[model samples]
Target: MSGKGALSGTEVATHNSRASCWIIVHGKVYDVTDFLDEHPGGSKIILKYAGKDATCEYEPIHPPNAISDNLPPEKCLGPVDMGTVKRVEIKITDQEKARLGRLQLRPPLDEILNLHDFEAIAKLVMPEKAWAYYSSAADDEITHRENHAAYHRIWFRPRILRDMTHVDWSTRILGHRSSMPVYITATALGKLGHPDGELNLTRAAAKHGVIQMIPTLASCSLDDLMDAAQPGQVQFLQLYVNKDRQVTRRIVQHAEKRGIKALFITVDAPQLGRREKDMRMKFDAEDPDEVTKSGGEVDRSQGAAKAITGFIDPGLSWKDIPWFKSITKMPLILKGVQCWEDALEAYDQNLAGVVLSNHGGRQLDFARSGIEVLVEVVEKFKEKRGITFPNPRFQLFVDGGVRRATDVLKAVALGATSVGIGRPFLYAFSAYGTEGVDKALQILHDEFEMNLRLIGAQTIADVVPSMVDATNIHSHVVAVPGDRLYDSNYESMQHARLRETTRAKM
Candidate 1:
């Protein structure tokens, strides 16, 4: 096991105790005994599979490079002789059988008329843990609800069309041509929903001529996704600055070298918000004894979000911006500016642009929606710097609660150069894999064509401020009109269920 040659399963099994544990991952054996306690998910999960193949358990939640990134090179014992290893039997429960049946019953892809349809189907078929992690937002989830509700207040003001027969929704983002004005925004742990994970997105985006923002925490390695890309397929990078400067530098320089079109650095999460649903799911999966293993010193219940994000540098600030600029010549844009003032600062700082976002409402509860922030940014930029919408020099992007093509048009009408859609695509692929995403993009394309004509706009440029009335966009108390599509897709929060009591038997 000392060298890089393949080691037999019997040899690895000899070091199965806590004193010197080794596990097989992707056919490689690693000594994780020293790493068990520091593992963000906790020591017990790893201990259960000590000296065994953990690839099945490890694939869904972690990025591909996680083990190599965290463990020392000396600890990587060698490649395992997988043929000689014992395979763990995975038992399917009754609940999973039921879920599989429901998955088969999903309506034909053609029947999935809108993004909401995909969400409804995914909710019924996705694993409970995946569903919780994908859907859970910050505390109270008020921001999450409001993110969608804000769009309802925006009223379209269509004018008599001069000629509606021809209309196109194609637009450019950060100077790259896109099929539509939407980019597949970054989402982590794609393998949680589908085995292919972000690769499904990469292939689909390439086929549809859509730009994808690759996530720092993607289950597939960055190089894997890049290698998967077709020649001339454009991609962007979304970075969560690492605590180690060298790690961040390597990542940034490598991305630039790999032909990344732009760098979208996430500036919202200093710490991930309290997603209670995700936390509860972690509790359900963990052993009770493991919770007390660290003597309560380390809280292992922060769930999937916190487990993967412990390396993020909380001290990230404006001071680090110059260093990022120095390392790479890629056009930089701040990804989570929530206020018009901050948007103004980004503009003043001469960055490429700023995405008026709240980290898809997963970071700060009650934070304003990207569209809401778009209106303010547009107005403030015009007032303060005398710059207007569609400024080629500095672009403004929006993301969050965007499910419809009409929503994209609205954001574009207000000021956004483009909008980013995250969960809807995640749901699409989760329900039906790559084909689901292809249909999802096609649905949007159709909607854009029809909506553009209906709104009496011929092109993306024709969608201006006068086309929509946002007079009530800021009114929080106004009862939003009942949306049957949204209502059907929305799952309300549930309280804790009472445990069943055992009765005395005769």
Candidate 2:
């Protein structure tokens, strides 16, 4: 089994051996055993490259700085043969590593573990315009900053030394179980971050035992996203409401046929918001063709602009929501609802769920942060509207500015049944591609697990409002009265018309 005569036999024998061994690549060694369960691309790829020279192949599969000397030596699992493996590594510089470390890495975690960390890194990794496109709010980005900043405003009363050891982060969303309470939000143009795009993201999400919301404007096709996402892995579709009704119908039908359990129809963007970053960059939202033509060569910074140009479809409305609902029995979740009024409306319309969000502050600049509205929305439904569903009941998911396990716990305590993560996953995608995304998610899961134990909560259900001080949570005042803030524009116009009509009657 040791010589050239037995080379093939030795290789065959090693594959079955229970013994684990280390492999060296680029002057670094990695312990492959522990990573078997954690491989983002799948264990088969890691297994195939086991005990072999995998440097060239693995090198191309990850961002350059992702496997640097600064990373734990244990995380390096040797090199593998490229001929039989799928290699997908986007170019990442050593400088980028230092930058990501300095900007994105929160002490003890070099990768994005939470939402804020991702937002910070995204600003660094992308051009000012692209970053603003993802991170900016409608007018002033007030909600964007507040979404994360508000998390600190809520103080957690942690109870120490309550449990002996056992803890679990696993939970279920819309009948699908996940390893943690958080899931990846559907963000368009993933190819901007890496070539594998949504395909890689869906695969990574499934591998991690969490849910992934596939966006309507995904770089990959719906069929491909569904195929990559394994069965029972909690894959949901995010609809951007394209102008063509037939296109929107096609997307909804595709999700239904593919077993997607939820339809996350984004409701905030009746028209694209005024993003100053994109505005400053002279980004033409109406003409994606011009932007793509102007953006030369897809690099880390400018890729998103080019990618976004391909996916953003402007026309969609509330009418389309019921149309989608009528077509599919799968649960419908309306994303980007920023106020109690819309949440109440969603409940009144009998939708399965509502995601309190500000589009990661990417859509509206001056909108209220999603976390700022979480408690109010939840209270409106649970108490005011008397809205309740069967068994697990109706859920409220929140996103935009969620960056820490505490942030997630805070949102949950405030009435969010679960939370969605956006920019952070994109940063992970940019920084380390799929592996980076997986590492980022794992860190968040770990943080949630540890925090749940520290707080003496055994399960996600145990994370209740009692853990949060409701009085301290931030609140905002809407100028318009009643629970119908969406009609603000219409109300103003109606008032003017009524005054004219009254004068005529007089």
lDDT per model, in order? 0.89, 0.62
Q: In model 2, what lDDT does residue 467 have?
A: 79
Model 2, runs deviating above 4 Å = 1-132, 283-321, 387-391, 475-506
> Residue-wise lDDT of candidate 1 within 352-386, one digit each (tens)?
99998888778889998888888888888888879
Residue lDDT tens for model 2, 1-506: 12222223233225421146344344344556554433333344445555554555454333233333224565653343333233334467786577556545433345444544544545555533334444444455566566666665676777666672877767778878878878889876666555676676787787888888887666666777777766566688887665656756776887888788788888877655555544434322223343245332222223223323323346565666677777788888888888888877777778888888888776666677777787677666667857542125567888876667877888776667678987778767665568767777777878887888888888777777777775655544312123121112111101112212345565
N/CA/C clash count, model 2: 14
Roughly what TM-score does model 2 have, to 2 decimal places?
0.65
Model 1 lDDT on a 0 to 1 scale: 0.89
lDDT leader: 1
Q: TM-score for each prediction?
A: 0.96, 0.65
Model 1 misplaced regions, further than 4 Å: 1-4, 293-298, 502-506
* Global fold similarity of model 1 (TM-score): 0.96
Give the clash count for each candidate: 0, 14
For candidate 1, give the lDDT of residue 213: 97
